[model samples]
Structure formats: structure tokens, C-alpha cells
Target: MDTQTLIYIFVGGTFALYIGIALWSRAASTKEFYVAGGGVHPVVNGMATAADWMSAASFISMAGLIAFSGYDASVYLMGWTGGYVLLALLLAPYLRKFGQFTVPDFIGTRYYSKTARVVAVICLIFISFTYIAGQMRGVGIVFSRFLDVDITLGVIIGMGIVFIYAVLGGMKGITYTQVAQYCVLIFAYMVPAFFLSFMITGTPIPQIGLGSQVNDGSGMFVLQRLDAVLTDLGFQAYTSGSKSMIDVFCITLALMVGTAGLPHVIVRFFTVPKASDARKSAGWALVFIALLYTTAPAVGAFAMLNFVDDVNETQYSEVDDWFTKWEGYGLTAFQDKNGDGVMQYRPGDAFEGAPDYSGETGPSGERALANTPNPESENEVYVDKDIMVLANPEIANLPPWVIALMAAGGLAAALSTAAGLLLVISSSVSHDLLKSTFAPGISPKQELLAARLAATAAIIVAGYLGIYPPGWVAQVVAFAFGLAAASLFPAIFMGIFSKSMNKEGAIAGMVSGLVFTFVYIAYFKLVAPAANSADNWLLGISPEGIGVIGMVINFAIAIAVSRFTASPPVEIRRLVDSIRVPRGAGDAQGH
Candidate 1:
């Protein structure tokens, strides 16, 4: 069968499976809608959690970005993986023991204030929405390329699928659907890695392949060869990072804490039956996540090597079918700057057009009658980095079915996270904002209706953001993580660990931390980003790393305020001590 037919069949089959799952798992109550009745098996919930947490960035974009950026991308691997450890250690068990419907629920009750609950809701909304845009955008990018549709159409198709399943079954639907998605996405991701790895390095394990010598009989390790290739082209080494060490540390720390604090991730534990299960499930979630994380670096390295080997300094007319096809999509552009009818891939002002070479010294220097020099001039062919992974299969001449699987996998990753975020938004709007605070007397039936409506609306907005994408999708998503770390993680941690913390202190810390982090990101990443350089940042922290400082600020302010304030209420103090004591804590009052 042709590639287009294969994609349609594969994508259609996965959508059918998800819709069937949604229909079969209709949620009947608010509890079911929000937390899958808080009775899911730990391993199943862990798989669902992995699907929900990975997002489009991990499945589609991260490896592609890593392919081009090289070793600097390790920050994502280390930071994201480490955060789950924090979750398993500091946050998941306590929150699951608390057994509320949402993050804001714990915050509201723990702080004994409607204001705190509302603040938590605001932060959750911002973080979830920001992250969902990236997911939706990922859906768009995948569909746009594979199906030959406009990005807007792709986002709409994804939104339609999500609207059906998410609005129908809520968390119950999302959880089961994510289980299926996890399976599909992981298989799809690994197949490419396996094929590409063995093709180049005679190793099926990507992590090993990254360290193994190339099949080209070069004694150098794959990374060593990759680094040589990169440096030869004036780019930084692939194995040795180019970013400043401090920025790397701060970004990694921020991601770890942010992962721990992310409301969508934390709320997944609420679906499980026990505090112990929550902790165990977090470990399993990492197992599921690590499958992709470990393979990504190898995929990235192999993809780059394949890409450069194929097109570097080759004649434009003689480039492979993949090159020609990608070029038609505007993803690959060629300009024959010093037109000799051959390709010149390097960094210059002159394009691939048949330009005069008689008097020109070229963008860097005169064209050689000798072997092709890696030019300092602008590359004749410009390839979009984002297209790297999606195009990898075709570039490597993999079987057409594998290309179809990539499409299905990309959709699976995107839709799973989209459903998870919509649940967070729906739960916040229905349970926290409306039912709990504004309409306390609302019927369960009415609240369920409200949840579905809110989900529908959130999906619509998410779809819109996917289409227009507001330009800061990556930064905004990253900023959401920073805000989670800086604004929420400390409060959540201290709520369990500190017995003497009062509502006054927790509230003050959270608010101050939020403002501090959000404003810094806005200033550097969004507001006056021209001032985002290292010299302008405090302690030379990049906008990406500023959240580490913001987190410290929260810890400092919370402790200082607690020292001067009255201790927690007698009941709240008892509650803290109760949570700390694990005896008989298994099912402690499931909300």
C-alpha cells in the first residue's frame, strides 16, 4: 500500500480504539469524571500518567530539537527524569493520602483559605493551558506533514477526537485511553530507534548504539564521529555541550521541581487507591517515560548523521526523493548561492539561485577548483530542525509502514496530554471554582454537566491556540514548568514536611514565589526578551533557569514568614501529624 493510505489506516484505527474506550468507560459521577473514582490499578495509572506527562514536546519535538542542538539537550532528559523522583519522594504519596479531587483542593484545605484555593486554580489554569498549546501544536505539526493538510486542519481533527473522548468519560475515559496511547506511542517511538540503530551501528539498543563505533568502519564512537561532523560544519560538538554550566544546572533543577509540582502530573496520583500505590506508581511512570527518554539521544544522533551524509555538498538535482519531497513542503529550501549546479551546505547571504560566480569571492571566499570546503557562507539548502524526526523515516528509507506508525504515535502523544490537561481544566472549573466555591449547593448531576461543558470549551480554546500557536509555545510551556517549581512545589512540600507552617506563611510564600517567577519569565522570555541575554540576567541565569532562584525565594519567604507568624490551627496541625504518620494512612478519606 502507498504511504498515504497506510497513515490513514493506522491513524484511523487508533482513533477508533480510543473512541471505543471512551464509550465503554463513561463516567457517571464527579468522582469518576475527575479522578476515575480513585480506584485505578497502580501500574495502569502509571502508564496513563506517563502518556499524560510526555506531551507533544517529548514525542515529536524534543528528539528533533536534540538532533540539531546536540548535547545541550541532555538538560531535558536529566531534568524531566529527575522530577519524577521528586514526585515519588516528596509530593505524590502525601497528596494521594490527602485524597482530594484536584491540586487546588489540597492547597485550599491545607491553607484554610478560599483565596489560596483560587490562587492555586489560577496557577493550574495558566500552567495547563500553556502546556496544552504545545501539545496541540505538536498535533498540528504531525498531521500537517503526514496527511498533507494545513496545520489548522490538523489541530481541528485532533481537537475533534479529544472533544469526543475527554468530554464523554472525563478522567475515566482519559485514563484508559492513555493506557492504549502509551502502548502505541512507545512502540512507534522504539521501532524507529531500533531500525535506525542497527542500520548504522549494528546495535539494537539506542543507548549502546550512541557509544558504539559506526558501521562505516570508523573506529571513533558514534558521538565522537557526530561531534567531528558538527564541528567540521562550524556547529558545536554533539557530545560536549555549548551552553554555560550554570544555565544548564538551573534549567535542570527547575525542570525537576517543575515536574514534581505540575498539577496534571500530581493529580494522576489521585486516581490511585492508596498513598503507597501513588509512590509505587510514580516509579512505574518513570519506567514508562524512560523508555522514550533513553532512546531519544540515539535517535537524534543517527537522524543527524543520516541527514548530513545524504545532502551535504551534493548536487541539488541529485538529492534523494525525501529531500525533493520535503523541499516541496517548504521545510527544505535550496539556494544555489555560488551556482555551479551542485549543492553547498554551509552557513552565507547568497541563496541557491543560479547566481553569478565570475567576480564573486563567495559568501566566505572564492570557490575552489579543489575539494569542497565547508563554507562559512549561508547554506544553500536550509532544513527546518522541527522536521527532523518526522522526516527521519523517509530520510533513512525505512519501510512505509513505519512512517505511518510515526503519524499514529505523534497523535497518540499529543491527544493523551491534551485530554489530561482538559481534565485538569475541567476539574478546576467545575469542582474548585463552581461547585466548591461559587455554587456549593449545586447537584452532582449539575456539576457533571458543568465539567463536560468546561472541557468542551477548554478543548476549543486549546484547538485555537494550536492553530494560531501565539509564537511562544516552547517558552510558554517551559515557563509553566518554572512557575510550577517556583510557585507551587515548595508550598506543597512544606505542607507535608513542616508541622508548624501556618496558612499565612504558605499563602505568602506561594503568592510571592508565583509573582517572582512569572514576572521574570515574562520580562526575559516574553516582555523585553532582547534583555534576555546572560549579562542582563541576575547571576547570569537564563530565562529558562530563573525558576531555580524563584524556588529558593519561595522557600526563604515561606520560612521567614512562618517564623514570625502564629502556628497552624490545632486541627490543621493534627492533620499534618496524621499525614506524617504512615500507619493506617492507606485510604485516608478518599475525597
Candidate 2:
């Protein structure tokens, strides 16, 4: 069968499976819709959480980021994975014991304030939307390249599939669907990694292959050879660090905290039956995630090496067939700057950024390309880093089935996270904003209808953002993490650890953190956008790292405000005391 037919079959099969599960496990009550009736098994919940946490950014765009950025990408690996540890140890068990339908549910009850709940819902919506937009873009990219559709059409189709399952099954439908997705995605990711590893290093294990000597006559290790290749080509060494340690520390810290604080992820623990289950589920979540995370760096390094060896040094006329194929998709670009057909894939510091369309002649009878038209880089061949994971199979000359599987994997990662995020957006609107606060007299059936409607509306918005994404899918998602770390992490952490924390303090701290981080990011990202590099930042913290500072500000403000306010009621203190232990916890009262 042709490659496109194979992709259609695999991708279509997964969709049918997801829809089948959604129909079979359709949510019957608000409790099932919101938290799967709080009856999910720990291991099952763990796999679901893995699907929830590793979005398009992780599966589709992340390895691409690593392929180009080299060691700088380690920040994402450490930050995202480490945050689960924080969740498992610092937050999950207590929150599970508290037994709430949503983060706002916990925040509202714990702080004894509707104000706190409202603030939290707003933050949750903002963060989820920011994060969801990236997933949508990722869906578009995969569909456009793999299925041969326009990106906008891809976004719409992805939205429809997510809507059918998410609005119908809610958390129950999504949880089981995600288990299937995790299987497809992880398999798709590893098959290529293992294939490429053995092809290059004679090892089936990617981690070992990454550190092993290449099968090529050279005795140097894979990473060592990569570093040598990059330096020789005028780029920084692949294994050496280019970013300041402070930036790495801050970015990693922000991602970790943001992962812990994200509403979609936190709500998964609420699905498990007990506090102990939540703890165990977090451990299992890490294990599933580690499978992909460890393989990613190897996939990235192998792809990079392939690009350097096969594409960079070869003349434009001699370029591989995949090069032209990707160019047809606009994922790769080339311009002969020096009047020589040999493409220069080195440091982009010497010429114009974009292709010059003007017929103006230069001294050497070559077309004179204007320098002002392009500013991103001067390199003659620019490959979109977003294409790395999806393109890896082709780069390594893998089978057509393997390439088709990569498409299915990218779709799985994108759709699974989109479903999870849309559910959070849906619940926040229907449960928190509408039913709980604005119309408390609503019936359970009415609330469920409202949730479905909210989900439908969110799907539309997410689809629109996906088509008209604000930035690179991964960078935009990273911004979401920074926002989450700044706005929600501090508030949630304080709500749990400090019984003395009052509504007034929580509100103040969240507002301060949210506004500061938003403004800082907006000023550089949209208002007066530029590189916004280390030299121009506050304390040398880039927009990516500013969330850590914002987190600090949130903590300081909350602590100061709480000291001057009245402490929690005696009853509230006892509730805190009860949550501190794991033995006496009971089944959560269903919504």
C-alpha cells in the first residue's frame, strides 16, 4: 500500500478506537464527567496522566527543539519530568485526600472564599488556553504534512474528534481513550529511535546507543562526533552548553513548578480512588513518561547527524529526495547566496534572511537578494525545527510504515493532551463559573449540559488558535508553563502548606504573579518584540525564565499579606491536619 493509505488506516483506526471507548464509557453523572467517578485504578490513571502531560510539545515538537538547540533542550527534559516528582511528593496525595472536582474546588473550600475560586478559575482558563493553542498548532502541522491537508483544515478535524470524545465521555471517556493513545504514541516514538540507533551504533537500546561509538569507521562516540560536526560547520558544539547556567536553572524550575500547578494534570490525581493510589499513580506516570523522554535525545542526536552528513555538505543539485519533498511542504527552504549551488548550512550571519524575488542583478550576474527582507538568519537552507520528529524516519531512510506510524504518534500526543485541556476548560466554565457561582440552583443534568456546551465552545476557540497560532507551537507552550508556574503554582502550594493563608492573601498573590508575568512576556513577545535576550532582561532572566521570578514574587506577597490577616478558623486548621496524613482518607465525595 502507498504511504498515505497506510497513514489513513493507522490514524483512522486510532480515531475509531477512541470514539468507540467514548461511546462505551459515556459519562452518566457529573462525578464521572469531572473525575471519572473517582474509581480509576492507580496504574491506569498513571498511563492516562502520561498521555495528558506529554502533549504535542513533548512528542512532536520537543525532539525537534532538541535537534537544533542541543544541550539547551535539556532544560525541558529536566523541568517537565522533575515537576512530576514535586507533584507526587509535595501535592498529589494531600489534594487527592481533599477530594475535589477541580483545582478551584480545592482552592475555594480551603480558603473559605468564592473570591479565591474565581481567581483560580480565571488563572486556570488562561493557562489552559495558552497551553491548548500549542496542541492545536501541533495537530495542524502533523495533518498538513502527513495527511496532505491545509493546516487550518487539520486543526478543525482534530477539534471535531476531540469534541466528540471529550464532550461525550468527559473525564471517563478521555482516561480510557488516553490509555490507547499512550500505547500508539510511545510505540511510534520508540520504533524509529531503536531502528536509527541500531543502524548507526549497532545497539537496540537508544540510551546506550547515544553514548556508544558510531558504526562508522570513526572510533569517536555519537555525541562526540556530533559536537565535532557542529563545530566544524560553524555552529556551537552539540554537547557543549551555550546558555548561562542561571537561565537553565530558572527555566527548569519554572517548568517543574508549572507542571505541578497545571489544572489538567492536577485533576487526574482526583480520578484515582485514594490518596495512596494518587502517590502510586504519580510514580507510574513518571515511568511511562521516562520511556519517551530518554529516547528523545537519541532521536534528536541521530536526526541532527543525518542532516549534517546527508544534507549540509552536499551540493543543492545533489541534495536527497526528502529535501525537495519537505520543500514542497514549506518545511525546508534554500537560497543560493554566493552564486554557488552548494548550499551553506553554517552560521547565518553573513547574508539576507529571506529569498529575494526581485530581478535586480548583482555584480556577479546573480540575483541581488535584499538583506532587509529576512532577519531570522542568513543560512541558505533553513529547516524548520518543528519538522524534526515527524521527519526523522525519512531522514534515516526508514520504512514507509515507520513514517506513517510517526504521523499517528504525533496525532496521538496532540489529541490526547487537547482532550485533557479542553476538559479542564469545560469543567472550569460549567462547574466553577456557571453552576457553582453564577447559578447555584442548576440541576445535575443542567450542569452536565453546560459542561458539554462549554467544551464545544472551547473546541472552537482552540481550533481557531491552532490555525492562527501566536508563535512556534513549542515556544508558545513554554510560555504557558511560565504563566502556570507564576500564577497558579504559588497559590496552590500555599493553599496546601499554609493553613494561615487567607482568601485576601491568595487573591493578592495570584493577581500579582499573573499580572507581572503576563506583562513581562507581553512586552517582549508582542509589544516591543525582539530577541529579548539575556542582556535586555531583568536580572538576566529571559521571558522563558521570568516565571521563576514571578513565582518568588507570588510567595513573598502571599506570605506578607497572610501575616497581617486573620488566621484560618479552628475548623479549617483541623481539615489541614487531617490532610497531612494518608491513613484516614476516604473516598472523595463525588460532584
Candidate 3:
């Protein structure tokens, strides 16, 4: 079968399985819709959490980012994986013991204030939306390239698939679908890496192959060879650090803590049968995630080597079939400076060559092009990072079947996370907003309808955002982590650890954190955009790292405000005590 047909079959099969599961496990009660009745097995919940946590960013953009950025991109690898450790050790079990349907429910009851609950809901929405935007973009890129559809159409189709499972099954539907997604995505990611590793180093395992000696006549290791070649071409060493120590520390910390704080991820723990199960589930989730995480660096290194070898040294217009082919999809660009047919991919420092069209020239100037206008533009460099994962099979000359698997994997990653995030938004709106605050006397049937309505509305909004994403998938994803770190993490942490934390304190902390992080992001990314070649970011820190600072401010303000407020009532104190115990799970999510 052709690649397109294979892709359609694989993607179609996966969606069919998800829809079938959703239909079979259709939620019948508010509890089932919101928390899957807290009845899923620990291992299954763990797999679901892995799918929830590892979005399209992890499956598609992460390895690609690492591929080009060299050692500077280690932040993603360490930060994202390390967050699961934090979740398992510090948060998941206790939150499950607290037994709430949503994060806002925990905050409202824990702080004994409805206002605190509303604030948490707002933060959850912001984080979830930021996250969903990236997934939408990812789905678009995958469809445009593999399925031969326009990106807009790809996004609409993706939305249709997600809406079917998410609206039909709620948490129950999403959880089962996510488990299936985890398998498809992880297998898709590993197959190419293993094949490429075996081809290059005679080792089937990529992690081991990365550290093994290269078979390319050179006696040096793969890492050493990659470093040597890239440096000779003016790129940084593959294994050595390029970013400042402080920037690395901040970005890594932000992602680590931010991962633990993400509502979509944390909510998965609520579906497990017991508090102990939540703790065990987190451990399994980390194991599933680490399978891909450990292999990612190897994939990154291999893809980088393939990229430099394929495009940089070769003539752009006269290069291999792949170059012209991808250009058809708008990913590779070529411009002939000085009207020369040969494309030069080198450092921009040389004045003799044409103006640098590389993104490094900053955003102010138009892209540099050679004398030719249409057929032979001046400076053409086209390699979208999103293509890195999907194109890896082709780069390595793997079997067509392997390539088909990757297409399925990309769709799985996008759809699984979309379902998880949609569930969080739906539950927060229907269960927390409508039933809890707006109408406490709401019936289970009414609440279920409300949840379905909220889910439908959220799906529409998600579709809109996916159809018209504002930024690159990876960078937009970073904003979601930032918002989670600054606003939700601190508030939830304080609400649990500090009994005296009041409504004013919680609101103040959340507002301060949210506003500070948002303004900092807007300042760097959109507002008052920088003018220099060097990014004029504060302290060389990107907006993604500003969350650590914002989180600190949230913690400080909440602590100060709590000291001045009256202590919690005896009943509230008793409630806090009850939540800390696994046996009190029923009372934790009080009726």
C-alpha cells in the first residue's frame, strides 16, 4: 500500500478503537463522568496518566528540539521527566486521598472558601487552553505532512475525533482511550530509533548506541563525531552545555514543578480506586514515560546528524528528492544568494555570503534571499522541527510500515492529551462551577447534562484554537507550563500544607502569580518585542523560565497574608486532618 493509504488505515483504526471503547464505557452518572467513579485499576490509571502527561509536545516536538539545539535542550528531557518524580513523591497520593473530582474542589473545601475554588478554576482553564493549543498545532502538522491535507482541515478532523471520545465517555472514555494511545505512541517512537541505532552502530538499542563508537571509519564515539562535524560547520558541540547555568536551572525547575502542577495530569490520579493506588499509578506512569524519555536523546542526536548531512552540505535546488518533496509541504526553503545555484548553510558571520535568512537574525528583518525571485530565492532554509519525528523513518530509510506507525503515533499523542485536557476543563466547569457554586442543589442528572454541555463548549473552543494556533507548538506549550507553575501549583501546595491560608491569601497569590507570568510572557513574546540579534530577555531567561520567579512571589505573598488572617475553625482543621488519611477518602470529597 502507498504511504498515504497506510497512514489513513492506521489513524482510522486507532480512532475506531477509541470510539468503540467510549461507546462501551459511556458514563452513566456524574461521578463516572467526572472521575470515572474512582474505580480504575492503578496500572491502568498509570498508563492513562502517562498519556495525559506526554502530549504532542513530548512525542513530536521534544526530540526535534533536542535534535537542533544540542545540549541546550536537555532542559526538556530532565525537567519533564523529573516532574513525575515530584508528582509521585509529593502530590499524587495525598490529592487522591483528598478524593476530589477537581482541583478547585480541593481548594474550596481545603481553604473553606468558595472564592478560592473559583480562582483555581480560572487557573486550570488558562493552563489547559495553553496546552490544547499546542496539541492542535501538532495534529495540524501531522495531517498536513502525512495525510496530504491542509493544516486547517487536519485540525478540524482531529477535533472531530477527540470530540467523539471526550464528549461520549467523559473521564471513563478518556482514560481508556489514553491507555491505548500510550501504547501506539511509545511503540511508534521507539521503532525508528531502534532501527536507526542498529543501522549506524550495530546496536538495536538507541540509548546504548548513542554512547557507542561510530562505524563511520572514524574510531570516535557517535557523540564525539557529531560534535566534531557540527563544530566544523559552526554549530555547537552536541554533548557540551551552551546555555548559562542560571538559565538552565530556572527553566529546568519551572518545567519540573510545572509538570506536577498541571491539572490535566493531576486529575488522572482521581480515577484510581484508592489513595495507595494513586501513588502506585504515578510510579507506573513514570516508567512508561521514561521508556520514551531515555530514547529521545539518541533519536535527537541521530536526526541532527541526518539533517546536517542531508541539507546543509548539499545544493538546495539540486538536492535529494526529499528536499523538493518537503518543500512541497512548505517545510524546506531555498534561496540563491548572488544568483548562485548552490545553497550555502553556514554561520552568518561572513560578509561575503548573502544575508542570513536563518531565524537567528531575529524577527525584525525580512528573510534574506539570493538574486533569484521565485525559482531560486536568495536564502532558503526550510526544516520545521515538527517534521523531525515523522520524517525520522524516511531519514533512516526504514520500512514503509514503520513510517505508517509513526503517523498513527503522532495522532495518538495529540488525541490522548486533548481528551485529558478537555476532561479537566469539562469537569471544572460543570462539577465545580455550575453544581458546586452556581447551583448547589443541582441533581445528578442535571449536573451530568451540565458536564456534557461544558464539554461540548470546550470542544468548540479547542477546535477554534487548534484551527488558528497563535505560535509554534513547543513554545506555546511552554506557556502552559509557565501558567501552571505560577498560578495553580503554589495555590494548591499552600492550600494543602497551610491550614490558616485564607480566601484573600489564595486569591492574592493566584492573581499575583498569574498576572506577573502573563505580563512577562507578553513582554518578551509579543509586547515590546526585542530589536537585537541577541534575545533581550531578562537575565537571558526566556519567558518559559519566569514561572519559577512568579511561583516564589505567590508563595511569599500567601505566607505573609496567611500570618495576618484568623486561623481556620476547628471543623476546618478536622477536615484537613481527615483528608491526610486514606481511610477518610469518602469524607474527603464530601457531598
Task: Give the top-scoring candidate (lDDT).
Answer: 2
Model 1 scores worst on lDDT over the 10 consecutive residues at 353-362
Q: What is the C-alpha lDDT of each candidate?
A: 0.84, 0.85, 0.79
Residue pairs that clash (backbone atoms under 3 angstroms), model 1:
335-351, 335-352, 336-352, 336-353, 337-351, 346-379, 347-377, 347-378, 348-377, 348-378
Give each model a TM-score.
0.92, 0.94, 0.92
Pitting candidate 2 against candidate 3, the one with the higher lDDT is: 2
The Cα RMSD in angstroms, rounded to one decimal, for candidate 3 relative to the true structure is: 4.3
**Model 3 TM-score, all chains together:** 0.92
Task: Give the winner by TM-score: 1 or 3.
Answer: 1
Off by over 4 Å in 1: 347-377, 584-591
Best by TM-score: 2
**Candidate 2 C-alpha lDDT tens digits along 58-103:** 8976787788888988898999889988988899999999988999
Sort the predicted structures by lDDT, highest score first: 2, 1, 3
**TM-score attained by model 2:** 0.94
Model 1 accuracy (lDDT, Cα)? 0.84
Stretch of 10 with least lDDT, candidate 3: 358-367
Residue range with the least summed lDDT across 10 consecutive positions in model 2:
357-366
Q: Tens-digit lDDT track for model 1 on 1-591?
A: 999999999999999999999999999989999999999999999999999988877887678768877778888889888998888888889899888999999988887888888988998999999988878877887887788898789989999999988999899999999999999999999998999999999998998998899988878888889888878976667777767889999999999998889998899999999999998898899899999998988988999999889988788888888777766655566666576867766543234321121112222221111124235566676665666777888989999999999889989998999999999999999999998798999999999999999999999999988777554554565678889998889888888888887777878888898899888888876677557677898887877778899899988898999999888889998888777778755668552
